[model samples]
Target: MSVTDEILTPRGPARVDTDVPAGAPVALLVLGHGAGGGVDAPDLLALRDAAVAAGLVVVRVTQPYRVAGRRAPAPAGHLDEAWSVVLGVLRDRHTGLPLVVGGRSSGARVACRTATTVGAAGVVALAFPLHPPGRPERSRAAELGTGLPTLVVNGDRDPFGVPESGPDVRVVTRPGERHDLRGDPSGTAAVVRDWLRDRGWTPA
Candidate 1:
């Protein structure tokens, strides 16, 4: 149960914490906090723990703005930099294993963008904020790309609801789960594990 903590100190300060096995069917999954919560938030913790139990290495991090204790998000440029630095660390640290990078809300958005360009093995987007609740006109669903294995665990009652219009999108909707995937750890864990396996990241 040993974990490594690396402080990424490039543009802004951030902490990258991970739990992984020394030698197993390893997959490095990097998660970011939501706009409102840090990595220690309960929902993120549950998902991180679940991934670890499923035998994939789990890396949780705080955005630079969040690390600075800012309630609002940082400018787009800074946030993007933070993601790149953290992912670079993941690439270096977990060499020879598949890499899965994603986040909660904005973090997931960043990961979705990065994955398409960076060629991550897969993506796990928990509580993706599709359109910012009631603003469907400004949709973020387009950020998701094709050809990569993606697992989106969102709540049935989530504000943007399910985007029932796309192919190759695996959607797991928890009955009462909100944008936070609240009260749905079991369901979340199952889908994520299955998704990891689908992407060739099975437990050893």
Candidate 2:
């Protein structure tokens, strides 16, 4: 079952929906939605189901602006601050389990920016926006790896550009997907499992 929680952050009230595996969890995944989306995105829901069945706790977070019924995303600093607050609240609740931070689009960028500070074991970026459309000078690839094992799933035709793979980064492309990744996320979930296995992590 999934439960929603209202978390107070510096910016506003953010919401999170959490799902846990039937058995003991091996790790926890904290996923954030994109700038214009909510926690109910198809990709997010798919990931949540896949991870839960594989014995992980999954939490989908809606940013403060989204919770307030705003379409425009908050500033990067505000987003990051709110995310930090959310983690602070969940940290004690899931102590001793490894945390993997992840998100889609702009949320993916936020995860990358905050992973190091939170000591995340991994990052899952779905349709990561490498740079704005028609703008290559504002590259955000440096945030991709962040000195941790990372998995990036993207659409082959995404206007955001194809993200490059590095030693710490593994990129998976969906032939028919666009930036939305519009369909089941089982493939991306399997990629996430493989990445964890490569790092010697297995579901309990």
Candidate 3:
């Protein structure tokens, strides 16, 4: 079963849909949506299902901007601030469990940027926008330097470009998919599930 909550943030009210496993969860996974998307994005939903089945509590967040019915994303600082507030509340609810944060595209960037501040143990960045489309010079790869284990999943054909693997970061590419990653959400979820298992965040 899923429980929904509306959280008050600095910018506005943010929404979260949470799913907990039947038994004790190995960890708590908090996910955010892309700039223009919501918590129901295919990839996010698939990961939620997989993570719950793997005995992890999953919470998908809908940003304040999106919750307010806006298609345009808020400024990066605003997004980060609101995200931090939401995470703080979630931490209080699921205390003692390892916290893993992540999301797709802009949400992924937010997660990476605030991972250390929120004391996240790991990050899962799906379809991370390496840079604005056709703007390789504007690289945001530096944001991925959280010094924690991170998993990045991107479609081979994503216009956003794929990030390269780093010492503590693992990048998985799904061929024939794009920025949306709708082609094989299950496959993307499988990769995440395996990564969690490798990190001992979930049962093998």
Candidate 4:
């Protein structure tokens, strides 16, 4: 089943839509949405279901700006602050349950930026925008180039550009999908499942 709750953050009150696994859960995965999207993105929905089936609790977070019904997302710093508040709620509620933080698009960028702040076990960056649409000079690769364990599932045809593979960052490309990757997520789901399993987050 699903449940929704709100938490006050520095920016405002953000909402979290939680999907719990049927059986016991050993971990929690918190995902934020793209700049122009919500928890209803097909990839996020699929990931929620797949993760639940794999015995994880997945929470889809709506930033405070979205909660206020704004189409434009707040600045990166604001996003991080609001996300930190949401992460705190999950951490307190789940206690020892390990946490994996991630998101799609802008959300993915936020996850990478705040991974350590939230003490995430690892980070899943779905369709991470390696750079702004046509501005290849202003690359965001530095964000994903950290030593932390990171999984990047990017659309090969994404206008945002596909990041090159790195030692600690594993890059998985999705064919035929752009930044949205909303139509079908089977391949993306499999990648995430295997990544988690390889890291021992899921039973081998």
Highest lDDT among the candidates is held by which one? 3
Could you tell me the TM-score of candidate 1? 0.89
Sort every candidate by lDDT, greatest first: 3, 4, 2, 1
Model 2 lDDT-worst window of ten: 195-204
How far is 153's C-alpha from truth in model 1 (Å)?
Answer: 1.0
Per-residue error for 115 in candidate 1, Å, reads 1.0
Estimate, for each residue in 1-204, the C-alpha lDDT of model 4 and write its tens digit: 789989999899999999888878878999999998998888888888888889888999999999999999899999999999889888999888889999999999999999888889899999999989899998999988656789999887899999988888999988888889865786788789789878877766
TM, every model: 0.89, 0.95, 0.99, 0.97
Number of clashes in every candidate structure? 0, 0, 0, 0
lDDT of each: 0.75, 0.87, 0.95, 0.89
The segments of candidate 2 whose C-alpha lies over 4 angstroms from its true place after superposition are none
The predicted structure with the larger TM-score, 2 or 3, is: 3
Candidate 1 accuracy as lDDT:
0.75
The residue-by-residue lDDT of candidate 2 on 1-204, one tens digit each, is 789888999898989898988888888899999999887888888888888887788999899999889999899999999998998787778998899999999999999999988879889999999989989888889888698989899999888877989998989988888898875477766777777666655543
TM-score preference between candidates 1 and 3, better one: 3
Q: Which of 3 and 4 is the better model by TM-score?
A: 3
Give every collision pair in model 2.
none
The top-ranked prediction according to TM-score is: 3
For candidate 4, report its TM-score: 0.97
